[model samples]
Target: MSTILFDKIIFGPVHSRRLGVSLGVNLLPTDGKLCSFNCIYCECGLNEERRTRSKLPTRVEVKEALVQKLAYMQSEGIAPDVITFAGNGEPTMHPEFGGIIDDTINTRNQFFPQAKIAVLSNSTMLHKEEVFQALNKIEDNILKLDSVLDSRIRQLNAPNSSSFNFDSLLKQLCRFNGKLIIQTMFLRGEINGEHIDNTSESEIKGWVNALKQIRPKQVMIYTIDRETPVKNLKKVSGEDLEIIAEVARKEGFDVTVSA
Candidate 1:
């Protein structure tokens, strides 16, 4: 029962095998899913099968629908390499999410001032200091650590917070000192019979030792490209994500294998 929902509060410029020509921005409820992580490799599914009576899009309606879709994608010349705060759920759990990321960085500085403003966050709202200063005023603050083991993030990210603390979320991702961007999602699964894998080998050596204490400037591994509300999930290849991205590119970290 997978139900991808992004009924527009400024939707796609699509095409993103890792954020290229993105443009999505649904501050939850174009009708359901308000995530604080219900991720069975979610593509807008799961979270009680998408339920919403709707109401979470007013920061002046996400800066006037992102200034009328960046002024109609700059009059249809359509140039978007990333405006993505992602959709259907968890756009920093919107409560005026830092004034809508300061009106999408002043409407991406009046029409795609060299794009890039991403947010796809699941680092459980970074203990909210205005969502950690609006994800440190974005430019792709990706964030999401699939498993540093809170029992494999409560059986693969089922975190609705029973005080979900992975050492206080790795000290709030080591306070983003390396300017975040560590989005992992490797898979290998099962559900009612318990059997999952975060690309094991001790879950990529404790997620590359918490990315060597959150020194992430980039490290986005991928897997399960859509359609997963929980079936016999298993898609971690592209040469096993470049062998788990060469164990974080041999710890010098700038990994980005997307598969």
Candidate 2:
């Protein structure tokens, strides 16, 4: 079995195909993960056993650890392209998310003033005032919207409950005023006997409509490149990714493809 890449508060300045060398900060616990969506493609594996009230690292803990690691990296003349809030699970799920963002910004500026702070969020908590505020403060607020169709979204993302609505969620995302970077994962597969494919014409049309309404600054289109928890998942080819990128660009949205 392959070991998990990110299982701690400060894990990497690992080379990312999209974000370049990123120093990761995981707000979720080292032992187990916590997230709103148990995505089939999540590298962290499915949230099988919930530890909802587990002790997440405090803001001070994150700040101190990150500051120490960052200081060491700087002294060694190693600079990361971005300090990312992405690891075992959703960073926004942390109770002190806002404070942690503030602390990261302050500390990172003191060290590598040039590195950007990015957060990879599932967009489920965008309705929360604190989550919205914290996301707005980050340099790269990359949010996920796999598909706009409610049925497909529920099937693909496997969100925690029935209360998750994609339409209303898009409306909330539109309020961001183009400050967000929307990311969509393109994949084709069978999950539990259901044909799980987002590359269909109808599905892409719905996604395009949602992108038009949200008007995000950029759209990062990519497919699975790692071992997914769910078997039988097919990776979208680079050619198909380019085609999707072209479709988004024609709609006047900035698009980047990572196949």
Candidate 3:
């Protein structure tokens, strides 16, 4: 039950293996986790294990902290390549998510205009109009679609909503119309005695087909890079990821693989 929580609203100009020089913004409670999907491979650990009594940062607080960090970075001649919304959990869960995005955009424009605004979301909240529109406005709306199969998705993502429909999710994603980036986590192993693997032939076939239909601008495939809540999970190999990337490439989608 290992977990990591961002202690501040704005953290890191840390080099991200996928996003590069990134600045993180955590909209969830700093001391706990709040996410729609209780992903077994989440670096932040199990949602229940990391539960807290803390409140989410206010929109004004987020904007002020971001501005302060950006201003100091400016003085130190350090510019972030991207301002990423990802930390303990689903950032869209915040009550003022849309307002926070608006504030972030204004603040980013004032400091690092060249930097992109990216949100790494689990894609459970796409049904919300405000969340959908806010994601559309960002440079990188990286949404997770671990598998095309409903059964596999349930096992891998463990989405909290009973109303979550795989088919409906695909439709909502299609609305992005190539504006979004689809990010998949590739891993294999057993969880609670059930064997799981998304890198299988059938799994890859179905996933690639879904990608073709959704038609995202880019596809990012990566394996677990940190300590996960589930200890039995295994990281997909670099060679295996390249194989998956080729399948995606044949579909005419730009793919990036992180092993």
lDDT (Cα atoms) of all candidates against the true structure: 0.86, 0.88, 0.92
Task: In candidate 1, list every pair of residues with a backbone clash.
Answer: none
lDDT of 3 at 70: 99
TM-score of each: 0.33, 0.96, 0.98
**What tens digits encode model 3's per-residue C-alpha lDDT throughout 66-141?**
9899999999999999999999999998889998999999999999999999999999888889999999889999
| TM-score of model 1 vs. true structure | 0.33
Q: List the residue pairs that clash in candidate 3.
A: none
User: Tens digits of per-residue lDDT for model 1 on 151-204?
Assistant: 888888889989986889999999989898989888997888989987879879
How far off is residue 101 in model 1, in Å?
Answer: 10
The TM-score leader among the candidates is 3
Off by over 4 Å in 1: 1-26, 34-38, 41-45, 55-60, 64-105, 108-116, 121-138, 141-182, 185-190, 202-217, 220-246, 249-251, 254-259
Tens digits of per-residue lDDT for model 2 on 108-185? 899999999999999988888999998999889999999988888888899997889897889889989999999999
Compute the lDDT for candidate 3: 0.92
Q: Which candidate wins on lDDT?
A: 3
Clash count for each candidate, listed in order shown: 0, 0, 0
Model 2: lDDT of residue 252 = 96
